[model samples]
Target: VRTYKLDTVLLILKCTQESKGCSWYIRAAKIAGSDFFSVTRYRSKHTCSRAVQSSSNCRRRGNPRLVAAVLHEDYPGQFDTPVPKTIVDVVHRRAGVTVSYSTALRGKQLHVSDVRGTPEEGYRMLFSYLYMLEQENPGTKTNVQLDADNRFEYLFVALGASIEGFQ
Candidate 1:
């Protein structure tokens, strides 16, 4: 198993058992001035193999939170055109776990959908904003652009104000 220390930014590896005199462990420290970690010390051999179980129940695929965090950190601006393969690679590199294409795609979909609500909800919010503006200021002009599917495309609001002495 592996553990992370956010305060020190160090990764620690140790035997599954916590008994004393167990010399199987490794400590990795982050190198300064670079995004790399070096193993400070390692025992290489293990004597607690008998105590370890044969079967494992831990997940091999990256979890949803981990996938989402990696994608958000790696692709902050590429949400509109997210590449699933690229996300998969990022997750593997950052978390030391390989995720399938479908997992990556689902993670991106969840993140994007959360940020950009459904088409109906988006339109409702847009219309409410337009209504608020019109009610607050009389004679305000608002224009909305819709796509072929009746989804919101663009918004233009004129506050009935002159720009550079021109209306």
Candidate 2:
């Protein structure tokens, strides 16, 4: 098993009337290690299994890269996973509120996610959420401090570009 420094970030999601959506998150360190181990495991396990069959025919017929299919079971719509452009409403609603990052930053740590989307959109969305959070929390001042130097520099660099450039 591998270990990493703890981190957290804030997430906000719009709720459906019936049920609030949930979030699943992973850290960057684990993501890197998992990528490495997954490739190794896929090669070894698939090769071992394939050994039981006619290797020559199997090699010709199969796309061996299928072994690298991660999150095939949990991610909805593998073959049909709805792309963001196609499912704007679902994407908007599914991204319910997340609080891991802001809290982690308070403790001077980092957080990560593998969510696919434009960084500009994420920044806009997060800012909107922060405004709302401030509104909801009324009395207290809502201030955000970047704990990591890299993150602070990244935010500055990103903001320097035209907002649309991120999209």
Candidate 3:
């Protein structure tokens, strides 16, 4: 099992079996205000062995780049509707590597950001596009609703009978 401390951001791992003299343990601490972590203490190099067989196909879980590429390349149109199981199946089929749902989710998030840009940038582009549409076609009705924070809540656009079929 693994345990984490909130104050120092230290992680401790120990064998689940309740033995007083178990040498299998690891302790790691996060560098303060940094994205780095260091293993302060480690033992049981030989005392602990794999209790269950590890799959060779599980290597892709560590490769976010590969997972992102798979998500973007294989299911471009299904980005908003992608299921984690579908991603797992595709990665296994193409690269013969298995990944967890969380890994697939992270990869999907990366792919979405890569394709759609950040939310702030997207909102900026949206406003610009709306302005451009109003400029190109005069008398176009464009309405935007925002919350108390001035963030986007809703947007409505009417082309003002330019199409001639619908009023």
Candidate 4:
């Protein structure tokens, strides 16, 4: 359930064993002037004796989008993309959450695509960028190498100002 006051928003999440008076619940409140949230009250121990604490439902699951966002925060402007195993390890270590390899791969791919545009869109924008560069800077040399099927393979550019400065 969600309850909010004039300056604070309160959120409460309960376990499925609530019918038996389980104390497993989390209560968090939003800080007044910031995007941060603080957990004011929480109970990790469940009172009910149904052996549900070890179940999958009781574990916290991070979705693909949440994983992507975490990756962005953890590794800003990162080089050397992390593999699925590394992604899982990082999430487990940092967030205490276990994610599947498939999910981790999807999240990493999503974050990478968000940072670097998709291949089709990138190729489309490359022409526009090269044209603008050549037009704005006279003597700017640009070359695009393509393969047999007319696909992008390589790109080379020489800025006019740089060439002039070199000479």
Candidate 5:
């Protein structure tokens, strides 16, 4: 709800209970000539209590992709660092969003899948990738061995540049 439209200069957000007179709001303004937005004024305290989230009203459920993106920033080089408990705690502390164990697991899974696709999908795209590799390098060589069931068994790649430089 854009109670106040976010513009290049100003961004303001009001509490869901604004109509009920809950005085929780934040207003940030862009610093002139720089790309920084500073919190100009804020009433961080939510005077109105939020209604208990019911099963039907699960809008607060953390988005897996958003959780994954935040996790990436927190553990950039090491995606596998945080475990279940750590994941739950970290998201709550950093994102101010409470998530269940399953949501955390799903977020990690989503992040990993985005970075390194499923083995099946990788194998499916392997030939096309190698084709482009060959086209780019001009003298690249690739050998992919398939088993009786046509499953991937072996892969060998020798770039044309490497071959020429060796001689």
Candidate 6:
């Protein structure tokens, strides 16, 4: 048997498990669509097909709340951390580029403490977190540009690109 990490185990359980109200994949499909497979493409080239194939059986299994609960155990942040405005200003000043949304939300201040981690470390962590968020809420456009320093930054949250500090 393939040994899975806690997150993977929870993901499989979430995407494959079912319940009376709805199954894991059914709900996820509503959010992620049949291309739920595409989300897992990085894990394995065949993950998409396998995930879709297993989705059917998962619907019969009943109740994915447990899986959600399990996944939550691993993912404590609810995407609640606010993307700070200072970071956004720094990004704009450093990048010498205007990220779309940042221009609009310029006046609205966000607390840096909420997303206060090392710039590079936070960059990677936030990317993974937002990637998962993209899987859950694939609603926004993601655009990326490099700063004058050549550091990467992202546009919208749904777009899945990293923002050096741009909100």
**Residue 47 error, candidate 6, Å:** 70
> Given candidate 1, what's the lDDT at residue 148?
100
Tell me the tens digit of each residue's lDDT in model 6 across 39-122: 332222222334345433322221223222222343343433224344344345544433333432332222222224456787
Residue 4 of model 2, lDDT score: 23
Estimate, for each residue in 40-150, the C-alpha lDDT of model 3 and write its tens digit: 998765344456323332343435566788877776745473676787787788877788888877888888877778888887788789889889887787889999998
Candidate ranking under lDDT, highest first, comes to 5, 4, 1, 3, 6, 2
Sort all candidates by TM-score, best to worst: 4, 5, 3, 1, 2, 6
TM-score of 1: 0.46
List runs of model 1 lying over 4 Å from the truth: 2-15, 19-59, 118-124, 132-167
* Of candidates 5 and 1, the better by TM-score: 5
- For TM-score, candidate 1 versus 6, the one ahead is 1
lDDT leader? 5
Clash pairs detected, candidate 4 = none
**TM-score for all predictions?**
0.46, 0.23, 0.48, 0.52, 0.49, 0.23
Ten-residue segment with the worst summed lDDT in candidate 1?
A: 1-10
Q: What digit string (tens of lDDT, one per residue) describes model 2 on residues 32-74? A: 4343221111111121222243323322111212211222333
C-alpha lDDT (0 to 100) for residue 52 of candidate 1: 68
> Roughly what TM-score does model 3 have, to 2 decimal places?
0.48
The number of residue pairs in model 1 that clash at the backbone is 0
Please give the lDDT score at residue 93 for candidate 6: 53
Best by TM-score: 4
Which window of ten consecutive residues has the lowest lDDT sum in model 6? 21-30
Tens-digit lDDT string for candidate 1 (80-103): 635888878878888999888888
Candidate 5: list runs displaced more than 4 Å: 1-66, 72-90, 99-106
What stretches of model 4 exceed 4 Å from their correct place? 1-12, 21-59, 120-124, 135-138, 141-158, 161-167
Using alpha carbons, what is the TM-score of model 2? 0.23
